[model samples]
Target chain A: AQSVSQHNHHVILSEAASLELGCNYSYGGTVNLFWYVQYPGQHLQLLLKYFSGDPLVKGIKGFEAEFIKSKFSFNLRKPSVQWSDTAEYFCAVTPSAGKSTFGDGTTLTVKP
Target chain B: GAGVSQSPSNKVTEKGKDVELRCDPISGHTALYWYRQRLGQGLEFLIYFQGNSAPDKSGLPSDRFSAERTGESVSTLTIQRTQQEDSAVYLCASSAEQGTKNIQYFGAGTRLSVL
Candidate 1:
């Protein structure tokens, strides 16, 4: 079985402030990691994903995440966040494809 | 539509009643999944199908929860004798690949409210 843990429950930041959200997963086999975001009253959409190659992966809206294999972590980062970035983020781990286990999610509130 | 679609964006029902939520996957997507999201909570896996066959259903909370897919396209999640605990947003996602990593496109989700 696989599981995901998000270190933070809620995060607040001012516009242009740097941001980082921590995620860790536990799985015995090959791992694929993903980050999804849900804006206020919007559907959940893909942020980024990491499967192989470079540990650093970038996604839409200037968001990025680094896959640290040794740490069992895929943390999302943004150098400068905007008010529109306010949303809830979820981290998921898939041992294969299709089926995934998700974390509890972290709510991000970016103040303008 | 270009993305996954869930019918009846919002549904309200009385406790002990029955409700059915529908999901229409992408045109050719072979992998479909169901998840539950409560207020201020993350998505909880419920079930998944690969080509109309359910291979993973360990996430279903209990016997009251059941789901099925047909023609490798549409899927329906049925809750028998719904409880207040069943009140949540039921999300559906679809992916094209079966074994490799692929982006799972999500639907707007059906909000199930039990009164």
Candidate 2:
């Protein structure tokens, strides 16, 4: 079974601050990675995904993630965050033939 | 007409009663999935249906939890003799294909409260 690990449970930052959320997964085969975000009362939305392109994948709202196979990590990053960026973020991975596995999630609070 | 849809946005049931949750996938989609989101917990895979073939029920937590899909349109997840622990947000998502790379469109979810 594949497992996902998120290094931080909650993160607080002021506006315009750089952000990085660590994510690691345990899977040896070909895998697809994704980051999803959920606002306080909204449905989960895809932030970004890595299928077969470059290691660094960019997503909506100025979010990006880098896939490092050797480290088994796909960490999410943003150069500067806004107050509206406060939300809960989840990292998920899916093997070629299995269902997607998600990390516990990291809550980001960007204060103005 | 746009995304996956789930019925009964909220449900409250007695511990010993049975409850059924419904999901309507987007038109033309061939793959549908069911997931559970407990409070403060990540989404847990429950089941997956690919077209008219037998569904992948490997992620179902226990025998008490079962799901069914009709054709390629609607799916129903049934909880037999629901318990308090069964309370959670049941989410439904659908994709165009069976591969892991396909993007999944999710519904707002059905919040089930088993008391």
| C-alpha DockQ of every model | 0.69, 0.81
User: lDDT per residue, candidate 2, A1-112, as tens digits?
Assistant: 8999999999999999999999999999999999999988888888999998799999999999999999999999999999999999999999998889989899999999
lDDT of each: 0.92, 0.94
List residue ranges in candidate 1 displaced over 4 A: none
Worst 10 residues of 2 chain B by lDDT: B97-106
Pick by TM-score: which candidate is best? 2
How many steric overlaps are in each model, in order?
0, 0
Report model 1's TM-score to 2 decimal places. Answer: 0.96
lDDT of 1 by residue, A1-112 (tens): 7789999999999999999999999886788999999999988899999989999999999999999888899999999999999999999998863468899999999999
- What pairs collide in candidate 1? none
Lowest-sum lDDT 10-residue window in model 1 chain A: A93-102
Docking class of 2: high
